[model samples]
Structure formats: structure tokens, C-alpha cells
Target: MRVLWLSSIACNGNTHSFLNYPYMEQFLNDFEFIYHPVIDSNYSLKEIVTETIACDILLIEGSISDEFKRADVPVVDIITKYAKIVKKIVTVGTCATFGGIFRESDYKDTTGLHFVKEVKIDKFKDLLNKTISLSGCPVHPEVLVNTLYAIKKSVDLQLDNFLRPKDYFAYTVHNGCTRNEYFEYKVDNHKFGELEGCMFYDHGCQAPFTHGSCNKILWNEVNSKTRAGLPCMGCTEPTFPKSNLFGTKKNMGIPQDLPLGVGKRTYLTLAGITKAFTIDRLEKKLFDD
Candidate 1:
């Protein structure tokens, strides 16, 4: 398949991140890479701008914009040209899938391919049948790799409403966190820098409610943010970067967002019961220490 990497409106972090994926070497050999800004290709920006490249799968990165140009040619025009020929459009990164951090301060009416923030875009009717959104600040390289492998093998991936593959987004980050015991018992991490307790209460850790396999996949194959004493930032969610980064929003002491598939009333009741116990073993981040 002839795959093209088209970008616009933000940092090319997804491209950089994907290049470092463990399966990158395998992907390089598997696909016919037509054009990429960072990777060497047979086609140049001049050729791409002037001619319609035959594309099978289009991998678009960065936020979509009308004004952004490459080789003095509008990226939207290039995208449209490829969109007509490609059967699958894999939008990598939150910028291309959901507009991400760029739309928060959009100076050029920039938006995502299929959805603008949380709403679907009527213009991208082509994506209705062919779009696969891998939304993350920088999409997890394995997620992108596996998605490609599945496509190459003709595997039918179950996708959510946002076109995100459900296999990765169905579970919350809290599923495999080391702080599960602390979170269950209602023990909270008082401040940052200590990897001892859960960051859900005082800190704005949205692992429980946010759907992502970050903790399960493990970034860099060594550790995840929660395991390294950082909050889950809720980057995968559409309403990411909500007002505060390190603080949680509450209403009468109840978190605005409850855990995945959990009801608010049930959660509050469970919280009250869980806090009633005093298990010293759960207090520490490590059991042996």
C-alpha cells in the first residue's frame, strides 16, 4: 500500500514519536512510504503539490487548517487529493483526530478531520466510512503500529463512536495502575514528587474516568505516568486539558467525572465505605519497603 504522511498546524510530535516505535523498522519494510517530511521518500513536496499521488492508506497528522501551506501549496488541497483515492484514513494524534491542544487557541480556524473538538464535522463526509482516529497528544506508537498491522492483515478492528479502536480505548488508565489499592481504599496522594499513593483526590488524576490503555501498554516499555508518580492528565479524552492540569474540579466535594461505567451515587457510597477501613499495607507505594 502507498502510505503518505501529511501534516499541518502543529508540532510533528506524532511523526517523531511513531519513528521511535519498536515496530518502526518492520513498518518501514512493509509499506511503500511515498512521502514524509522526516523520512526519505521517492516523492518530493513539489511532486506531491503538483500531482495527485496514488494513495491506499492516508496517515494525516497535526490539526487540520485551511491556511497552512507546504511548498506554497495548501495542505487541505493535498489532503483532498489523497482522500479521494485512499480507502482508509488513519488520523494520528489528537490534533488530527480531535483538534487537541491546538484548537484551544486556534488562530486560523483549525480543526480535526472528522470531528471538531467533540462535535463531528459535516465537511469530512469521506471519513464517515474510512476514518480511524487514534487520538492522543502523540499517539502511542504501539497503537499506531498494531492498527497498521491489523489493516495489513485485513483484521476487522472494533472502533468506538469517535473511530478510536475500542481494543485500546475501551479500558481506563486506572485498570493497571500500581495505585489501584490506594484508589480503592480512598487513600490520596497529598502532594507531588512522592510515588506512594494515588493522585486521584487532591491531584487531577483522571485515570478512573478516562478511557485509555496507557497504563496497560506502558510508555517506552519501562513505566507509565502513574507508576512514575505523575497523574494520568486525561489526554485521550475529548475534553482534555480541562481548565487545570494538576487540580481536580469538584461539586460539593464530588468529582465532576466519575469512573468509567460507574454511577455517581454508587461511587460516593463506595467511597464512604472504603474509607472506613484502615489498612496500613495499602499506605505505601511498595509492599516490601
Candidate 2:
């Protein structure tokens, strides 16, 4: 019941996401909450390294680095020391579970805390069985809450190849999307903020191919970035923000990436057919100012 939360080389986006949980306060009541970066009952990095706290669970945030220097000490060494005593370890956020955007920089020398881009490290193999990964640009709050609840209750939890819980990531972002109707009819939104057209074709939205339930759960209990005139950006998928996010990928006038299992030829053929029969409603504004 004693949890030791830690972070390294991150902007604290996951912490912010967890704070937005509707039932966060209620859900947290189940655990002792021994330690966290921005919550009750926590310790500083210096205190953690000094072995001042004894914990049963280790929750890591942000990417790991072998050479990351913090106050003249390496964070990787600090985490490994705690990993030795903890019964369970949870890597929160894509940065901690899988090398994220921060890894692009040289100084941080960042990589996932456990498996570095699908490649596992032997140093942490002994603790793999106790490890649970919650990956997202900033992990969804529900994912963290549900995982903790499952562990505390000692219930069986299903996980995928990446060690992520199945319940939350079982479906793609395309599932239950409001713009699904437009996607089915091959309607493409030529510009940002159009509610009636799909963003996959011309706008670089990755909802169809990316996994997660942004559309199903709905962020802030109202809408997601995609639903409110923004694109999915594939924040949950491994290959996120693929080079030059401002534009879509195309190879020979066709989208370089297709929906989950869609064939390139089939997608193009359908797109051509749908483009020929442009509906006036799809082209006209759905809301008036």
C-alpha cells in the first residue's frame, strides 16, 4: 500500500492529466499514497536517494537516462536502488514507458525507464513481473486510477504486448468518434475546425490508426482536442508526432499510412469514389456564428 512516485526529464504533463480525473479524490482514498511528485505524502529526489523512505510500490514518471545529472547524481542509479526493494513498479506516461519527445535532445540522454523502445533491459528483468506500464503522451487519468485499484484489490488485469492494461487501450481512437460518419463516407476536412469531415485524409489526424479512447471517454467530460477542432496527433501510439506534424504523410499522392488494417489500394479507391459524390451538407457549415 506504500507507493513511491518519482519523475525524471519530463514537463509533468502526466501529473496534470491525473489531476483532471473526475473521481480522482475519491479514487485516491483507497491507497495510502506514500509518495508522489505533486500529491499528498511525497518525498524529494534527495530524500528518495538517501533511503529515508521504505515503500512497497514504485511509480516512475518521465523517461530514464543513464547519464542524466541532477544535483550531481544520476537519476537512473537512484531509481535502480529503489527498484531493488519495491514489490511492484509502474512506469507512467509514454516518456517513462517508452522513449518520448524529450529523447530527441542530447543532454537528457532520455529513454523509457524500463523497455527502451520495445527493447527490454536485463537489469530490470527480475522486476518485470511486478511492472505495469501506462503509456500516453500524458497518460489518461482513468488508466492510472483503474490500474491502482486493480492492484490494491488483487484482481486479474489483462495486458497487451507492451505491458499496457487492455481495458483502456483495447480500442482505437476511431472508435465512437463523432466524425466517424465522415470517415466512413471518405469525407476529408480540408481545414481545421470542421465538424462534419474526417481529418485523416488531408488534415493528418491519426484517430483511425491510433489506439486509445479519447473519443469514447471524452476529455474534460465535454470534448477532446480532436473533437474541438484539433487533430488526434497519435499521442498514444508509439510513433507519435512523426516528423513535420503540421502536414500529412503522402507517397505518390496517397496517404503513407492507412487505417489500422486498411489496404492502400482499397483506401484510395474508396476515397476517389467518395470525393466524386460530395454532399452539400458536408461542405456547408454545421454551426452558425
Candidate 3:
């Protein structure tokens, strides 16, 4: 398969993150790269913009903008050209999928390839069927690589409303979180760098509501934000880079965003019941300090 990787208004965080993939050398061997910004490839940026290149998969990184140019060629023009022929279009990060952090600058101008923060982009509405979104602050290397292989094997990836592969995005970040028990008991972690309490109550952990395989797959194949005592920032959601990320938005001691499918009343009742009893083990340090 041949891939033409392109970027628009972006920091290239996804590219840097992808370089950390343990199997990158093997992946490069399998896929023929027609043009890549960082990697040495068969073709240069000048050729990609000037000539018609046969590409099977078109990987777009960063958010899109009308003014942003690559090789002095408009990014939208590049996408419009290749989007017509590419078999698949993979938006490889939250920025490319839903405009992410860049959208905060100018919601009208900076936008995703197909959708702008849940709103579909009419210009590329015709290509929605062939587009796949891999939304993350900097998408997990495994998720991107695995999806590519699935595409190679003709696997029909079931996507969600966001056009993200359901196989990876279906699971919530809380699924494999280590502090699930603490969350259930409504124990809030008051301070950072401690593994004793759940961050959902106070530290703005969005694992319970946000969907991703961060906890399941683990970042760098070792630890995740929650595992390291940091909160899940909900970077994969359409409304990423929300204000005051360190503090959970609440309404009179109740969280504004409850766990997925869990009603506010039900959560309040459960929280009251859980708070009635104390789990001595949870209150004590797991190991002697």
C-alpha cells in the first residue's frame, strides 16, 4: 500500500508520537511512502503538489485551514486533489479529526478535514464514507499502526458517529483504570503524585466519560496518565482543550459530566450510599511511606 502523509496547521505532535512506535521500521517496510514530511520517501513535497501521485491511503495530520500552505500549495487543495482518488483518508489526531486545540484560535477558519467540533464540513461531506478519524491529542502509535494493518487486510472497521474505529474508541478510559475502586467509592484525590484516590471527583479526570484505549493499551506500553497519578484530560473528545482542564466542572457538588449512561440522580444516590461507609484499605497507603 502507498501512503502520502501531509500536514496543515499543526505542531506535528502526531508525527513525533508515531516515531515512538516500536514497529515503525517494520511498518515503513510494509507501506510504500510516496511523500512524508519527516521521513525520507520516494517523492518530495514539490512532486506531490505538482504531480498526480498514486496513493492508497492518505494520512492527514494537524488541523486544516484555508490559508495554511504546503510547498506554497493550499492544504485544502492538496486534500481535495487526493481525496478524490485515495481509497482511504485517515485523520491521524484530534486536530485532524475535529480541529482540536487549533480550533480554539478561530473556530470558523481552523477546522477538521470532515467535521469541525461535531459539525460536518460541507466541502468534504462527499468524502465522509471513506474518511476514518483517529482522535487523540497525539494519537497512540499502536492505534494508528493497528488500524493501518486492518485496512491492509481489508478489515471493515466499525466506526462511531465521529468516524473513529469502534474497535479502539468503544472502550472508555476508565475501563482499565487503576483507581476505579476509588472512583466507585467517591474517594477524591486531593493532591497530585498520590495513588490513593480517584481523580474524577476533584482533579478533572474524564476517563469515565471519555472514550479511548489509553488505559487498556497503555501509553508507551507501560503507563497511562491515571496510572501515573495524573488525570485523563479527555483529549480524544471533540471538545478538547476545554478551559480549566485541571478542575472538573460541577453543579453544587455534583459533577457536570457524569459517567456515560449513569444518570445524575442515580450517581447522587450511589455517591451518598458509598460515602456512608469507609473502606479502610483505600484510606491507607498501599505501601508504607
Candidate 4:
């Protein structure tokens, strides 16, 4: 398959994530690159982005901005050109999937390819059926590789309403976290630098409510932000990087946001039961080092 990477109003974080794909050579062997910003390619930026370029898969990164121009031509124009020819469009980050963090500046002006923050863009409405979204701040490399492999194998992927492949996004980042034990016991870490507790109750760790199997797939084959004492920040969701990212918003001791699909009363009942216990194992620090 011929794949081409396109950047809109972007920082190229997804491209960096793609470059760091663990099985780089194996992935490259399966696809032909017509043009890629970071990789050596047969075509130049101008040629690859033109209306006539052949592309089996168009991988888009970054949020679409009406103001962004490339050599006097709007990025949206290039997107229109490619969208007409590409067999399938893969929006590789939350930016191109759901108008991510970049949209905070001007949400009305920035948007994703098909749906912009859960709403569809009528201009590119025809492309919706052909689009696949892999939403993340900097998309996980494994998802990119696996999605490509699935397409190459012609395997049908179970997709969510957002057009994201369910195989990778079905589970939350909290699904395989080491801190699951702490979360289960309602033992939350009040501070930022402690590894002995869960960040869900106190910190703005939205792993339980956010989609994406970050903990299960792992980042750098080693760690995730939540595992490294940082909160999940809900990068995969439309409302990511919420105003107060370090602290969880509570209204009368109840978190403003509950876990995905969980009712507030149900959560409170479970929380109340769990909070009754002070498991010594969870409260005790493992090591000073």
C-alpha cells in the first residue's frame, strides 16, 4: 500500500511517535511511502500534496486550521485534494481525530477531518465513512502499526462511534496500571511526587474515564505518565488538558467526572465502601530510594 504522511497546523509529535515505532523496518517493508516528512521518499512535499498524487492511505496529523497555509495554499485545500484520491484516511492523533489541544486557541476555526469534537464537518462529510481515527496527544506507535497491519491483511476492525479501532481504544489507560491496587482501595496520592497511591481521587488522572490502552500497550516499552507519578491528563479524549490538569475537580467531595459509563451514585456507593478501609499495605511506602 502507498502511504503518505500529511501535516496540517502541527508540531509533528505524531510523526515523532511513528518514527519511534519499535518494528520500524518491518512496518516499512509492508508499505510504500510516497512522501513522509521524516523519511526519505520518492516525492517532494509539493508533488505529494498536489491533487494528482497517488495515495492508498493518507495519514493525517495535527488539527485542521483554516488559517494554516503552505506556500500560499491553505492546508485545508491540500486535504481536499488528497481526500478525493486516498483509498482510506487515517487521522493519527487527537488533533486530526477530534480537534485536540490546538483547538483550545480557536475551537471555531480548528477542526478534525470528519468529526470536530463529536460533531461532523459537513464540508468533508463524504469522507467520514472512509476515515479511521487513532486519537491521542501523541498517538501510541503500536496503534499506528497495528492499524496498518489490519488494513494490509484486510481484517475488519471493530470501531467505536468515533471511527477508532476498538482493538486498541476499547480499554482505558487504567486497565493495566500497576496502581490499580491503590485505586481499588481508594488510596489516592495527595502529592505529585509519590508512587505509593492512585492519582484518580486527588490528582487529575482521567485514566478511568479516558479511552486508549496506554497502560496495556505501554509507552517506550517501559512506562506511561501515570506510572511515572504523573496523571493521565486524558489526552485521548475530546476534552483533554482540562483547565485544572493537576487537581481533580470535586463538588462536595465528589469528583466532577466519574469513570466511563459509571453512574455518579454507583461510584459514590463503591467509593464510600472502599474508603472505609485503610489498607496498611497501600499506605506504607516501599522505599526511600
By lDDT: ranked, best first: 3, 4, 1, 2
TM value for model 1:
0.95
> Which pairs clash in the backbone of model 2?
none
Model 1: CA > 4 A from native: 284-289
Top candidate by lDDT: 3
How would you encode candidate 1's per-residue C-alpha lDDT over 1-289 as one tens digit per residue? 7788888776898988788688676788888878886999999979987998787888989887887888898878888888889878899989888888887654487788888878988878765788888988888999988888788787888999899999999989898998788888888655677657888887889899887888899888888898887888888877765778788788998888788888988999999898788887766556454
| Residues forming the 10-long window of minimal summed lDDT in candidate 1 | 280-289
TM-scores, one per candidate: 0.95, 0.89, 0.97, 0.95
| Candidate 3 lDDT for residue 24 | 79
> What lDDT score belongs to each candidate, Candidate 1 first?
0.83, 0.76, 0.89, 0.84
The C-alpha stretches of model 3 lying farther than 4 A from their native spots are 106-108
How high is the lDDT of residue 243 in model 1?
Answer: 72
Give the CA lDDT, 0 to 100, for residue 31 in model 3: 92
**Clash total of candidate 1:** 0
RMSD of each: 1.5, 2.4, 1.3, 1.8
Question: Per-residue lDDT for 43-77 in model 4, tens only?
Answer: 88877645467788888888888787665678888
| Candidates 1 and 3 compared by lDDT, better number | 3
- Find the 10 residues in a row with the least total lDDT in model 3: 187-196
True-structure Cα RMSD, model 2: 2.4
Q: Model 3, residue 31: displacement in angstroms?
A: 0.6
